[model samples]
Each structure stands twice: as C-alpha cells, then as structure tokens.
Target: MTATDPVLRALAHPLRLRMLTLMWPGPLSAAELSRELDVSHALASQHLRRLSAVGLVELAEERDRRGGRERRYRTVHGSPLSDRRDGTPLLAGTLAHNLRERAGRRAPDSEGVTVDGELWVDPQVWQDVRGRLAALAAELHAAARPPHSPGTVPVGIGVMAFALQEEARPEGDGRPNPAGSGPG
Candidate 1:
C-alpha cells in the first residue's frame, strides 16, 4: 500500500490510530470521541470522516441531538489491518508514535515488559513465533474494553518482526580468522 492506499493514509496519523482503538469495542460519536481524546469537536469529526471515507469505519447509528444529527462510528474490524507489505513503513511510523506516547504515560512503579531482537532464526521457528504473536494480538483486541472502564488496566503492546534480505558479504570478508588456530 502506498500513499494511494486510503486506509493507510487515513490511519497514518497517531490520533486516527488512537481513535480506531477507542472504537474497537463499541461505537462512539464524534463529540464523545472529542471528550475522550481531549480534542475539539471539529477535529474529532474530521478524523472520523477520514476513517469512514476509507472504509476503516462505518456509521453505526445516528440520532437527533440538540436539533442536529449525531453519528456514531465503529471500526470495520476489531483489529484493523490492510495487510499490504508496501504499507509497513507507514504503519511502523504510527506504531512508533503510539509507543512514545504510551511510554510517557507509563506508571514508574508498575511492572512492564519491553524487548527487542534482530536475530537469525530457523524458518520454522520464525513461522511459529509469528503465528503466536499474531494470535496474542487478536486475543488482546478481543478482550479490549471501553476506554478507562472500571476494574480494567490500560496496557500497551507493539510488535514489529520481519525477515530482512540477506546482506552480501564484501569480497573475501568471509575468510576465517587465522587468530582462531588455537583456543585461548
């Protein structure tokens, strides 16, 4: 997916990603989103329109309020993904922004987990790990609750794993070191 991918373009913003998560469990009107996200009504509405335009969200309901119509929108899927390899960079940037914001809100005294890896692994191992990671993400989305609900804790998880192209060794760089003739 390139800039031409509407879903990618719509969700390229941090706020739009946040809005999508907020709507995963249920529908929310623009005004409600504004209050929950601490943004102006117009801004929330504009983002909602963008999401809807891309088919990432659909109008769930509409009602008359204060002589004006109020529209509620829900995500098309609990976990939204265009699943295009070309869109990785945009999604990565969104995830990075989200992680930074969530990290700042972390509770210093509370336990948290963070890990990074760039290792070479067997193909089967990589496949199994990828499947488990995806399942865990789906499970989390399934268990999501409305924002700030009682007895629920807010947690953030970001996963980015992909196989990189094998780098070509420079001429003669692969030769074994002569210094390894004997164990030290």
Candidate 2:
C-alpha cells in the first residue's frame, strides 16, 4: 500500500481512534489499551497489529509484570497515517455521523458533552488560506530545529490540522455552526 493508504485504513475504525487516544500520553501495551478503551485483549491486540502493519505504530519488546517479553506500542512521529489518501473523507464523515448520533441519544438532564464545529470559507479564498498555513508550518519546522535561545520555551505540541469541503445541505437544516463549535 501507498503511504496514505495505511493511515486511511488505520483510522477507519473507531477502536483505532480510541487506541491512539490511549497512547497519546505514552506507549501502552495491548492489555492496558484493552482495559482503558473497554475492549477485549484480543481485540486490542488485533488493532495494534493492524496499526503496526501500517507503520503508524511501533511495537517494542517490553517485560510484563511476570518478566516475560510483551509487546508495547507507541505512535510514530508526524502522523505515520496519511490524510491525502482515498476513502479518508468518507471514513471521517462516517465517524462524525456515528458520534453525533450517539451524543444525540443522551438525555438532556444528564451531564453529557457534545463536540461540534464547522468552518465556512469563501471558495476563492480556500486555496490561498491552506497554502499560507502550510508555509507557516514549514517555517515553524525550520525554526524548531535551531538551537534554543534565552527566554525560549521548549515544548511538545500535538496538532490536528484539517479542512472540510462543505457538502450540500437541504434548506431548514438544523446543524450547529461549523466554524466555531466547542466541546460541551
């Protein structure tokens, strides 16, 4: 498979996203992921295997409490998964729809949270906006490699950057604003 194909496939499953979130803090074993994500150990192992197959995760030999070698997985740098591959858009939309549906089923009186956001931009400005963001990112990467100066802050940042092309919606649709939504 090409570079982006694995990313698309790795992210195609909801369980994989949960796995990534679990590993965001640090490397985790299949047992830990299963417990944290509420998945069976076998299921967690399968997910980790798939992610490793795509190079999105690296498995290291680590000792379990029993002192036997067990596999631990960590996320690869720079999103070993690709966003430019085919089927990514559809997969993303499906995941969004499922999450929204799940949120909508909760009782209003319950202390539930919902995340929603949308961005509306003029078609003519889209390309220019994206190009400017890319240029800025490249500049940051170039600067990040240089030696730190006095009063500089060294930090690890996790960034999720993406754009959405609006799909046609029927009149009187009642979805929340796209450009400025936050976790509830």
Candidate 3:
C-alpha cells in the first residue's frame, strides 16, 4: 500500500481519525486507544489492523500492566509519496479515489460552486475574497482547540463559500445563467 492510499483510507472513518489524533504524539497500547476513543477493544484492534494492512501503522511488542508482552501499533510517518513531487502511481490513484469520493458527495452542490464559476468573476472582488480565505485558513489551522467537554458532540460544520452572479446576456434572452468566481 502507498502512503496516500493509507492516509486517505485511514481518514475516511471518524473513529480512525480520532485514533490517529490520539496516536500522533506517540504510540499507545490497544486498550489505551480503545479507552481514549471510548470504543471497544475489539473494534479498535480491527481498525488498527486495517490501518496496518495499508502500511499506515506498524505493530510492536510492548509490555502491558501485568508485564506481559502485548501488541501495540504506531503510525508510519516516513512516506515518500507524501512529498507531492514523488507522484507515485499508488499514491496518485489513492488520492484520486479519495478526492472522487468527496467530489461525489458535493456534486449536487456544484451548480453554484463549480461548473459555471468562470462566468461570475468581477476579477478584483474574487481576488480579494480568495486572499481573505487563504488568510483565514492559515489562522484557523493555527488556532487552538476548545476545551473538551464530558461527552463528544457529533456536530460537524462544513463551510462552502463562492461567488455567483447573473451573466450579461444577449437581448431578448430571459435565461439567467450563474457565473462562478474565485482566486487563481
């Protein structure tokens, strides 16, 4: 399995994402992972197995509470394909597949955000918005996380912003076409 393939597949599941976030700092035992994620040990092990199969993680022997050797998994961060220039076929296809899945979900919302976006440009305005968005993305990533609550919230926020406007049409044509615009 390629780096991108595993990264994408590992991230596809919410539980897996949580597991990854937990493991990012260091390796943890399966029981510790399950407890942290509030999942059953069997389920956590299963996810870890899937992750390991894709080369995203490696299992190691660790002594548990009773001083018995137990299996533990850790993420494999040294992936060449992760460096965009490598363009390995496996990584490319996995990335494409992952993106395609996300695209399929947004296809229905494409009319306003894609397809006809070229027509909506008031070139200057789009540039300004794009700059602001880029700044926001940087700042957001740099922001600190909120304090954890006693229980997890399933709430998810998806922000989609784009410009849409009516195109200047020929005389007597009543059709209103949407134009889309964004930063280059």
Candidate 4:
C-alpha cells in the first residue's frame, strides 16, 4: 500500500483490483476467482501471483481439493489510493476501467450514487470530508460477505479524493479565492 513500483505495477491491471475485492471478505483460491470473474484458471493464478508478489495479498490457507492443492489468498486491506499519490495517475486509469465494468453489471432496478467533481473548499472542511470518506469505505469493506451470499446484494463503489495545487495567478490577485462548486 506504500505505492512501491511493484505494488503499483501489480495494481495497474483492472482485474487485479477486482480480485482483491473478491478476496477481501475471505480467502479464495485461484480457481474460485476464475469462476467468479469468468477468466481462465491460468489467468487468475497469474494475477494472484502478481498480487502476492507485491504483498497486497497473502496466502491464508492451502488444502487438498480433488487431488490437487488449493491455495487461498486474502487481501491485506491497506489504503492503496490513500498512500499519498505516489502512483495515483496509474491507479486512476485502473479504477476507471473497473468502474466501467461494474456499471455494465449494475442491477437495473437498483438506485446508486455516482458523482465526480473538482472544486476548492476550506481546509478544515476538506479534512473532515476526507476522513468521512475513508470511514465509509472501511465500513463497506468490513461489511462485505463472501460472494453471492444469500440476503446480500452485490454492490460496486469507487471513490477518489485529493487536494490539488493552486495555480499561480497575476501578482495583483494574490488574495485567496474559492473555486466554483456544484453538487456531485
């Protein structure tokens, strides 16, 4: 989650992000990921190894299954996007890709929140909102259940927020001026 080169590289793929989410609630073997994501077993194993190599996932268990050993991995649960923007650019593209995929699979009768924006706010207000966003994300992850559990509905959520640098304006306009804002 420190945004090291390997970690960023491993996360650049959209499928890896989805795999981490699937494994968040519980450990899952490569075969399970393949079945859930509709990818080949080899493809799932390749991505899982990349995730494991970066320490984003760890082997939680290994057991015999149909005469072969099955290894299950679980997410490490660090704040990948909150690691201080080291690889935010690359991660942003990955997020966009995954978001599109999720949107396609969205349940027709379900209402969901989807918003995006860029604006300036008071420093204290920004801080408060950021903390709340992080809390909500953690709560969702903690509430997650294994895939397709009865009485649980599948959901997709993506959030990204960061402070932007102020651009230099004319010397005469050095006074602080808030940027435009709208509901999102």
Per-model CA lDDT versus the true structure: 0.84, 0.62, 0.55, 0.88
Clashing pairs in 2: 118-178, 118-179, 119-178
In the range 25-139, model 2's lDDT, one tens digit per residue, is: 4578988888866779999999999988877778654776776767777766464433454675656664665465445555556663343446666656767866775666556
Best by lDDT: 4
lDDT of 4 by residue, 1-184 (tens): 5536888888889999999999999999999999999999999999999999989999999999999899999999877657547788889899899899999999998999988888867899999999999999999999999999899999999888888886756555546554553221
Rank order (by lDDT, best first): 4, 1, 2, 3
Q: Report model 1's TM-score to 2 decimal places.
A: 0.87
Least accurate 10 contiguous residues by lDDT in model 2: 152-161
TM-score for each model: 0.87, 0.54, 0.42, 0.88
User: Cα deviation in Å at residue 43, candidate 2?
Assistant: 0.8
lDDT of 3 by residue, 1-184 (tens): 7465445655556566455545543577778788876789999989988877777677655665676767777666443232334333434455455445446556343443322234455679877976786666445433423224345332221222344444556755655444442221
Residue 14 shift from truth in candidate 3, angstroms: 2.1
The sequence of per-residue lDDT tens digits that candidate 1 reaches over residues 76-126 is 884455345767888899989999999998988989878887787788999
Score residue 122 of candidate 2 by CA lDDT.
Answer: 66
lDDT of 1: 0.84
Candidate 4 regions with alpha-carbon error over 4 angstroms: 1-4, 168-184
Q: What is candidate 2's CA lDDT for residue 167? A: 75
Query: Which has the higher lDDT value, candidate number 1 or candidate number 3?
Result: 1
